[model samples]
Target: MMLYYIYDGTFEGLLTAIYDAYYERENPELIVAMDNFTDNFLIQRRYIDTDEKKATKVHNGIINKISEDALTNIMYAYLSEHENAGKYILEYLRFGFKVGRLVDSYLSDDRVHNIHKLARKVSRERHLLLGIIRFRLLSNNIYYAPIDTQYNTACLLGDHFAARMADQIFVIHDVKRNYGVFYDKSKWFISDIDTKGNLDLHEKELFYQELWKKYFESTTIKDRLNPKLQSHFMPKRYWKYLVEMK
Candidate 1:
């Protein structure tokens, strides 16, 4: 009979499940996130809670035994939120432990390739948002920027902006997840946000937005429109946060 290991839908929980799997000497057929788990009479299931100690142990194993890049790939895969992502992460880690740093060179292997592929997608999104993310000054002097991403990438995006804009107080709200990074000049932290309604903008913010829109309009030549090419570079979904689109 195949065994299934289930965990709460968190990175820590997933790491704990990995720790349990190795400790028990069991190669579970599935390492499923609870949000994606389904009951099956044929398969035995065990649920694992998020344990910081266990998660840290597994994280240390990955970093010390495998490679730092492997840990990065695991994080990116977790953020991918793809179907059976937990299972894939476990499989990748198991393979990584055996091969050490060379696990990344196994491009022909489906499991290794998938991890790389998912991580690439996440890296690509993070890179795009770094350039396109726009911030507006709030009524209370906070720089606020709201983004809706298909991948759970706000945390990664937050880290990038925090380093670049370390001197400014800002909020990078992930509207889809109802959470944001609150940066207070000295440091940045993630927290839940109240996204119930539209935020009130500063009076000057409105003026700058209008000025930006005008600049975008004035620079464009109607005769040279290439929407297909433009859409290739800038997907239509991201236009919602763009000042020019407003």
Candidate 2:
């Protein structure tokens, strides 16, 4: 019989389910988010609550027993939010606990391979967004940048921007996910924003954007233009957010 551990669609919740699976000694066929779980009487499903203590125990256990990098890999995989991401992380951690730090090195195994791929995918998007994100000055004197990303990467961008633009008030909004990271001069945090109306940009921001677009146009030589090569470096999916591209 296939038993599914259904969690509250949170990382901690998923970890708590893993903790239950470990202590209860029940092998769940799949650990699914509540939103993903279907209503079916034939399926044996257990709803796991987000328990901080149990989740922390599993979190610390992974760090102390396995490698710190293993924990990071798990975080990235979870942030990937792929349908099978939770399942992959559970299997990856199970293997990591048994073999210690060398868990990721055994990528030849499918359990190890899938988690690593998801982590890499999220990391790659984070890296690209760091370069591609364009911030505009707003009427409230805040720097606002909106992005539409495939993965949940808005939260991952805080530390990088917080350090780079230390003195500025900025918000990196993931419009697709409808959440963003707010960075003050001192720290950064994530929250939702009101995106119902048009953005009120500073008068100078429009001038700056136009200037940037003109500069790009002036520098371009039609004879030497290679859009394919340009898009190779800067993916077409992100062009919609770029001032010059617009």
Candidate 3:
């Protein structure tokens, strides 16, 4: 029977699971999220509860022993929210602890390569979202933008927007995840947001939306229209939030 470790799907929980994997010597075939676990007669499942101390110890060790960039890559991979992200992080750490900072140089190794691939995917989405995200003026005077992303990237955008729009109050909501990063002009943090009907747009925002749609139509060259190439660059998935795409 193959052993599998399961956790609550948080980054800290994943680190705690790794701590157990190392200290208990439970050589599991996979590290999986509790919600994603599949019951199988041939697999032995071990549940790992999130412990801050143990998680912190492992987090510190990764930074102290391995490179800080390794931790950043691991965090990016974790934010990917991919099914295999936890497993890849475990394998990456196992190899990293042995080779120290030089572990990143082993791109030929599948363990190292898997993490880099996930991180790159997440980084790409973050960069793209920064350009494509559109904010609307809220009735409460806050700026709000809703996004549905492949990876967990709403929180990743907090720093960039906060720096650029320092004097503005805004919220970047991740529709799929049901959470947001809110900025109050001075500080920002990730927290649960009310997604109900209360988020009414400011009166002028509706006019602005209409104006943007008109601008899009007016600027288009009908004779040279190429949706295939447009979709390739803009991606169809992001159109849901685009006011002009409506």
Best by TM-score: 3
TM-score of each model, paired residue for residue: 0.92, 0.93, 0.94
> lDDT (CA) for every model shown?
0.88, 0.90, 0.92
* lDDT for residue 34 in candidate 1, whole number 0-100: 81
Angstrom error at residue 128, model 3? 1.0
The stretch of ten residues in a row with the least summed lDDT in candidate 3 is 192-201
Estimate the Cα RMSD of every predicted model relative to the unseen true structure: 1.9, 1.8, 1.5
Error of 3 at 34 (Å): 1.9
Q: Rank by TM-score, descending?
A: 3, 2, 1
User: How many clashes show up in model 1?
Assistant: 0
- Consecutive 10-residue window with the lowest summed lDDT within model 2: 34-43
Candidate 3, residue 220: lDDT = 94
lDDT of each residue in 1-246, candidate 3, tens digit only:
998888998889999999998888767888888878989899898889999999999999999999899999999999998888888998899999999999999998999999999999999999999999999999999999999999998889999999999999999999988999999999999998777768788989999999899999999999999999999888999999998998
lDDT of 1 by residue, 29-137 (tens): 8888787777878989888988999999999999999999999998999898887677788888989999998999999898798899899989898888898889999
Better of 2 and 3 by lDDT: 3
Scored by lDDT, the top model is 3
